[model samples]
Target: MPPLPSHEYHVGIICALHIEMAAMRAMLDEEHGTFSKKAIHDHNTYFGGQIHNHNVVIACLPAGIDGVVAAGTVAKDMSRTFEQLRFGLLVGTGAGIPNLEAGVDVRLGDVVVSRPSGVYGGVVQYYRGKSKAGGMWEPKGMLNAPPVVLLTALQSLQAEYELEDSRMPSYLAKMLERRPKMRSMGYARPEMDKDVLYLAAYHHVVGRTTCDACEVAQTLARPPRVSTDPQIHYGVIASGDRVVNDAVTRDRLRQDYGALCVEMEAAGLMNDFPCLVIRGICGYADSHKNENWRRYGAATAAAYAKELLLHASIEETSQEKPVQQILGKSSETTRSEQDWAEQFFSKKQVTFQ
Candidate 1:
């Protein structure tokens, strides 16, 4: 792979699925230019375009692949190609960790922004620990907090939203209008009335796509929210190697770890990349999982990402001397991720285990 043109693209956004990637790509205000470059090591393509005043590049996994390991490989290759990358944004859809019983009523189509509170960082990987047949477990290591710059920007955005209101809904509306394909029922916003919360033990009927087959009498009664607009929750995000479809496990994890959202990719990126994780809540992390609100959830997260970028400045993100310049290397393929591991994480070893 040849070197990218010596232009500074300060931001890199990564998504796990095509829908998530499309949601973000649709929000580029003025795509002044577009280009694709393959990673020298993995051959994964990184798409580049201009969004607002920033040069942004996005990388996504090939179809049908999902998990932390794949995310790490794509992010690694993306870093190699976009040498001027300052920080990355893992923007995508995830499962909500809502326990109406606990007053944490995160519904479908809401957005969750990982923010550090107490000992937990912005994101935590629940699958990192060891398990035994007796239900015994050993805790795994914790991931570092997101870069200070991202945390600062998140605080600013939160304060601004508190004073007024979120612009995510309007941004999503315009995005759907611009990209009409996202206006379909599956991708378009779902009716707030259809958002249901079923009993954890009452699983969805097998081979059914809709919830009509599930016993409506088993639903959990909760006070309706005043706003249907996507509400943003800030706190720890639970990430693991597998999808959380079991409500029993989801609630157990939520009760145990206080996770606001559940996802599959952010854990891997935590090792070498100091970036923020923003996820839209599409499903309830239960047996009744469906694509009904996934597209809308992804759109909301992408819109929030764009809103956050408006507050970011290149000066803070580019404080570190350019790694490419420091190494005096034209292409990053000459150095492996092991080289970066030494620089980023130091003597501490990082692995998917």
Candidate 2:
């Protein structure tokens, strides 16, 4: 069969980092290769393929360009060319807010999904606001939510999880079996001992790249679980332009927004493109953070995203509204109109859920 046209691709997955894209790409059941771009201005490098019954096109932000602004540009360019994106999955690594007393003890390599836990609708941009006084109005990433088809799928998957654990382990194992070299790059789960949570006040020794130089005595103690399998949690995810590398900021965001995870790019996608953010916990949002678990973190989140897609029926996905229509335009919309603020604010019910 011929490769699918960009219009036929119903799902779009955006990753801000290369490891995130690599892990997501490995989850594809069939690699369809890139289709011809309909717009020359859409600079995103597309990796088209199928995930179960859905045609998923995955793209990563261009090299060294990250944060909210870069993410919005990538999503806008992608939507223009693909034309039929029902919704997006922003899969990547994020700084986790570990709150043991809150039952949201997010640990390294685990996955945290965006789901409505309060008024925030799963993902909220804490700094985003209409008023010039940034603190007065939270960024509007709060205004959008994953579409109904995806929410329905999320609910179904959550219900299934109550009966059994997530299928991420099986999926991750399969992905590694297909791409064995990923194991060398740390895609496989690290030893339980390495998954340490340090004290909030304890800063890593300056100029040291890894935790090996840091004192383990300053770390927080917790009993180890019998199984080291990555757990999946659902709740509000805080989205902003800054990285939370200090315990003070991490604790503050959690207290203020009730966010379980923090990341840099979700705010960009949430305001314009409707998407679900899935992040693997690469480190505790603290001074001791390192890249040790990043590869595995990226893989676990990708695995959960793959599992979520399986729950969404292709028929329902097909019936959903195209992204262009949601943005108050059509696939043929001019490039200038595509990125305008008027087009986005014109639709009051952009969430479509």
TM-score of each model, paired residue for residue = 0.86, 0.88
What RMSD does each model have against the real structure? 7.0, 7.0
Q: Which candidate is the best by TM-score?
A: 2
Clashing pairs in 2: 128-138, 128-139
Tens-digit per-residue lDDT, 1-353, candidate 1 = 23236356778899998888888888887553444544466567666665667778887887887777787777776777777777789999999988676678898888899899777788876655555455543336677787777888898888899797888877888987887777864667788768888888888888988887888899888787787788888998987666667787777677657888989889878756667999988888788856778888888899999989876766776784432343321211213433432332222222221
lDDT of 2 by residue, 1-353 (tens): 34588888989999999999999999988998866655778888989899998999999999988877788888888888989988899999998997877777788988999987778778876554442343332444344777778889999998998898878899999988999999988899988888888887787788877788888898888877877888888898987656667776677678767888988888777757878999999987777755779999999999999999989999999998888777632212234433332332232211110
lDDT for 161 (candidate 2): 88
lDDT of candidate 2 vs native? 0.80
> How many backbone clashes are present in model 1?
0
For each candidate, the alpha-carbon lDDT, in order, equals 0.75, 0.80
